[model samples]
Target: GDSVTQTEGLVTLTEGLPVMLNCTYQTIYSNPFLFWYVHYLNESPRLLLKSSTDNKRTEHQGFHATLHKSSSSFHLQKSSAQLSDSALYYCALSDRTGNTRKLIFGLGTTLQVQP
Candidate 1:
């Protein structure tokens, strides 16, 4: 079984501050694909970044995350936080079960950026 964890349920930050959302995962598979999905107020969740290679950094939409196999972590980070960056972020792990691939999502973290 595979599972993802997002330590922060809510993160509040002022504009221009650095942002970090902790994400960690555990799986029996040797190589697992990790992903970060962003959900806006009324929009469908979209993929922000994904990586299967260990120790490689993936970036999208001003956010970046590195997959660390040694620590089993894929923490999302941004140098500066903006109001537009506020959203619900989900950490997910890809799993393949009997020719089908599915994603296991975490509880999700809400990023609230204020002016």
Candidate 2:
């Protein structure tokens, strides 16, 4: 079965620093859309970045991630990560051109920024 895996379900942080969350996936499909969704306190998860083009990275807001079919990975990263970055980050996927199923997700990483 195709599935997404994210390393470290939680990450602790300082007021101003960098945060990197590992995201890997396994699927037989060659073309799958990878996405990063950010869920703030009370708000629903919102799209951060998404892409199906291999090696071509996708970025949104201040976050960036890329899809690597060869590595079967799409790790999210940011420079000088902020306190406001404290929230939930979910790595997701939507399969091939013919598949219309809803997206699937990794458990998510809860970023705790300490002021």
Estimate, for each residue in 19-106, the C-alpha lDDT of model 2 and write its tens digit: 7888898876667888888899889899888874899977777788888888889999887678888889998877867757568899
Cα RMSD to native, each candidate? 1.6, 1.5
Q: Among these predicted structures, which one has the highest lDDT? A: 1
lDDT of 2: 0.84
Q: Could you tell me the lDDT of residue 60 within candidate 1? A: 84
lDDT by residue for model 1 over 22-77, one digit each (tens)? Answer: 99999997778888999998999999999857788888888999999899999999
Clash count in backbone of candidate 2 = 1
TM-score between candidate 1 and the true structure: 0.93
- lDDT, residue 44, candidate 1: 100
lDDT of each: 0.90, 0.84
lDDT of 2 at 103: 87
Model 2 residue runs over 4 Å out of place are: 99-101
Per-residue lDDT, model 1, residue 43, is 99
Estimate the overall C-alpha local distance difference test score of candidate 1. Answer: 0.90
